[model samples]
Target: MSAAAHPREREIAADLRLRAARPPVARLSRKVLLVGTATACVAIAGAVAYAMAARPGAASRPELYAVGGPPPERLAALPADYAAAPKLGPPLPGDLGKPILAAGAPAPTMGAAPSASPEQQRLVQEGEAARTSRLFANEAELRADPSPSNVGGEPVVGQGARAVLDGPVDRRTVSPDRLSAPASPYLLQAGSVIPAALVSGIRSDLPGQVLGQVTQDVFDSVTGRFLLIPQGSKLIGLYDSQIANGQRRVLLAWTRLILPNGKSLVLEKLPAGDAAGYAGLEDQVDRHWGALFGAATLSTILGVGAELGAGYRDSAILRALRLGTSDTFNQVGQQAVGRALSIPPTLTIRPGMPVRVLVAKDLVLEPYSG
Candidate 1:
């Protein structure tokens, strides 16, 4: 029992010593680490300096080029006595070359006057005297008073004198070439109106025949009792479909007139009018604002899409493809916009719209008996 207790006591003592003893921790000092880092940096700097100092200097700059020699002479190294070939045409009879060569020579200085012959001197003196006499004569004429007979109360004017107005003048007066005598006693003269109403609708989409019915009685210009065009007469006409931008009127003309009794007359291209006597009919005008706005919006969208991500760098092929696509989109957008702009405004005149037949010329017709 003493031996077993002695072994247990030794074991307990060893465990106590192990628990009291602390293991050593490996910790690097901040000063030592800083010192080692500085040393390494200094060595690296020294190596860099040595490398720089050992490298050879750059090559010397090349000297500037000397000025070029003078150009070669034009006539140097040419054959001596190189005369021109003989001329193919004969010369003129007179010595015309002398005057031409003399013209090219240096002109004489004006320091001294040329010697003049006696006749020339006489001519010059006579001319001076005549000029002086003329000057004196003009002065006298200007100073002389007019005769009492010529100085009348009214001023005298030449027969060619005429009045003129010089401002921006236009032909305000026209000849009466359009005026004409009445064709017949039973005639509807110019400035006359035959009231009517549209029998068919007018759409500017396509050109087609239009129909109308006279709504009022038209009479001859000579007699008030004569009835030329009665009410309910059919008017066969055509309306123009060529619409322009912002245009709201539809031009139409009557070509033939048919009475209720079946009697027809072939009328010329007589123009249509409104109640106010204005040419063409007006009702509805469609400028297609929605279509225009849509086109503009589409163009803007295409432009924005084309310009997206344009700042980013890309490969040559990609860049080229992007530019091509951008240009294609841009062109398509522009074409779409242009096509929208080119669309003309639509003019519509609904049925039952009041219209008039303006008589541009004389119309001879038999009085309606029915």
Candidate 2:
């Protein structure tokens, strides 16, 4: 209806009309593509949900049945009469409460049956008769009987027979009498030193006597020669002071010194001094106590490690703690006691060590030897 259109404009108008008039196939394809995508997304979501449900996890599934089934009755729950039906009745005619032994059974012996043969039995009986007869016989009658002849045809006195025949069994022969010797200057002179060493370690709480030995030869000052108290003589010392738990000091004085000649000289008085290496010994004991404390600590640590390695349970840990604590406490107590009563430094002489002793008075020589 407008003015006559140009040839170029008519071509352009025809192109626009053709574009507008064409079917909306692209839009339809886009919708179709969107629907396919949505379907695929739904399928993926469903697969994921199924996988989650099938996988084993902490989540609990619903039980098929809600209530539990009835419990089965136990045999113990039956009536007393029913339970007692299987028990056996007494077999004896009278209810004596004793088990009935099978018929034809031999009576049970109190102990093993005698297995001795007739010859052995005869010998045993004869020996028993002889022993009874001898027991009733007087000592004089037993002694009057002649000695039994030996295999060599020589009459030999049996020890038993000789004991009865011998005269009143000399009391001295049975138990030797102790020598009664007075203190003599010839035995041990005063102001004489005897070198000796402890036979064993003596504790402050030790009871009774301590033993020692002479380390070297003891010489007489006036004689200028080795005295009868030679080297290797045994020295028995009686602690002068009482050995109490809290008392650590010790004063050892020789009571008796046995000479090499099998004779012993009893000492009456002995002087106390720091002659032996007792000081050094006391120091060593102190060090030992310290080491013991350290050992206790180390043991406690080891116990803890052992308990952990075994298993880290509440009970195990507690038990280990208790044991360790007890052990530590015991060790501490021992150390405390030891410290309270430290051994005197003057009495700390080791075995084989040289020691000097001063005899306070003259000693007596006794025939007895220890």
Candidate 3:
């Protein structure tokens, strides 16, 4: 029994040694080990590559933000801070409602921040996400200061102001509704007639007030208002009688008066109103003024100096080409009150514009009693 068992054990051990020493078994084990090592290395490398590539795009995105300038209404406009902004409307009573302050409230509690409303949060989020989004093109910081040549000029410190003039309905003219201004309005038609006959013929026998004096210039309150009485002042409108407490509120843009002494007067006043309104009116004036006064009757009849007698007036730089018998003014007059026998009428262009015009007074020439 012992001998048989021993022989079998010896044979089994020999067979095991033979299998371990075989070339194919050892070669196959080596190949298997190499493939397993390569697979482990690839898996490890791929995980690390993914983590590295994702860091900035993921974690740093929230911290990346662009700094921008303050909004337009805030540009150098008075009362920079909201608190300093001028209070419009009726003044608040001495006592306003109490603003109950929470003594120890957290600066930033969970869920939502106290300082920002939902709308504000949306704007902030939009601005923060703008670089990657299509809301506005990408922006980058450009320092205007800490430069060499910028110091000498009106250096824009940080980001300077910007104004855009593009929009629908160019905001550069007095639209029809603007002329009837709130305070005072003037009607304007470029060279309309002055009704001299109407003014002279319809004589009012009412008490007449003498304006100019023959004496030397001094302060006189004759018309119950201030009056400067010099020949030079009289030639011009140095004295204005409040002709009824200025209830007659029309601003004359320009006028021409051929005084008895043969002096021409050309006066122009500015259009006054809201900033937007003034800008619009100025734009319209620049666009249409030359075309306007070019063919009116007043341009013709007020007749150029060349057509008048020796002492004829009307000498102004604006009137450089104005002295032709048929000027832009006379045609306007003819168009206004047609030919021959006519009553007195007046034409005026006022400071305010409504794209149209309105007139409250008439002009008629009157002969002085000698």
Candidate 4:
């Protein structure tokens, strides 16, 4: 017998017959699907191709690359202007090249113009001459003693120039050796003192007299190391008398100090006034007065009290006698007080007393040889 037709086979045949009998819609659908799939694949491939082309190492845009990249083998040569120098305007005017000057401006000078006046110029010339002269003199002195035993013997240009230019040696720059054996006048400081002794006796009433002789050397006030006045210098003064509190006091007014170098200088009074022995006499009198007054007052009080007590109990005659005794004691007390308060005589200054005097002004003295 023939195999019975399978159910699946029958269904397959039916589906094939239905598909064959239908319109071309299924084939069209398949074609549409295939076209869509092909379109999507084409779009994906275009995107990938674009990404690879846009990568970092990819070439720039065609226009920029063509201009910036190396020239092509057939490139044309550049124009002549590329190698030519730039054109410039005409040169500045000759007058414009010079510096402009304002009206009334002084003419240009080769160098700084002389600013010194005639007198100043003369002085400068004189100073220059003096400096040159001193320089030559110093050179000569140096040559004369190329190996001089004493280097100090060389004359200093500055010192000599100062002497010539200023008309006198500058005492400030004077060497100690030169000052020690001074041949020029030297100024002494203020407040310097010379010990002196009275040459003759002088009383408070005396007016003018020679005072004394300097017995000791004196030094300069500025440079206390330098000797200013030597021994045996003369001192002259006036005995100035004044009346104070009805007492005459005398002061030795120094007038002149004759230095041993034969130079005379006005002298001032010593800074320390008269010695203690000459002061305070009036104070002593006042003390005496105070003591006497105190004693007298006490005595008077005691005498009056005693008289009153005696008179109260005594008869008239005895009372009178007691009063008289009291009066006598009171009178004695008054007399003692008056005597104590009396002004004493003025102090008298005698000559031959040692004294010190100061230089009135700056004194220029030469060194004494004796």
- Each prediction's TM-score against the native? 0.51, 0.30, 0.13, 0.30
lDDT of 1 at 57: 68
TM-score of 3: 0.13
Instruction: Give the alpha-carbon lDDT of every model.
Output: 0.82, 0.59, 0.36, 0.60
lDDT of 3 by residue, 1-370 (tens): 9988999999889988844565654346888899999999999999999877845445544536555756567565667578987667554333431211221223354685468788998997886465333322222322322334555678565434321222134766765654443221222222221211111111111222112212222222222132222233221112122223212222212123334454343333212222232211111111223333553434454655335542346466434654453355566566654432232222222322232111123222222212
The deviation in Å at residue 48 for candidate 3 is 5.7
The segments of candidate 4 whose C-alpha lies over 4 angstroms from its true place after superposition are 1-185, 246-249, 268-346
Clashing residue pair totals per candidate (backbone < 3 A): 0, 1, 22, 0
What is candidate 4's CA lDDT for residue 84?
A: 62
Decreasing lDDT order of the candidates: 1, 4, 2, 3
For model 1 the local lDDT of residue 113 reads 70
Q: On a 0 to 1 TM-score scale, where does candidate 2 land against the true structure?
A: 0.30
lDDT, residue 320, candidate 4: 80
In candidate 2, the residue pairs with backbone N, CA or C atoms under 3 Å apart (3 or more residues apart, or in different chains) clash, namely 278-348
For residues 195-284, write the lDDT of model 1, one tens digit per residue.
999999999999999999999898898876799999999999998998888788999999999999999987798999998888999999
Model 3 regions lying over 4 Å from their true place: 1-41, 45-256, 259-360, 366-370
Residue-level lDDT of model 2, residues 254-331, one tens digit each, is 677777777776675364344653421231232244555666565566556544544345596677776676667566
Candidate 4 lDDT tens digits, 260-316: 667787666433123333421121112345666686787778677756667356798
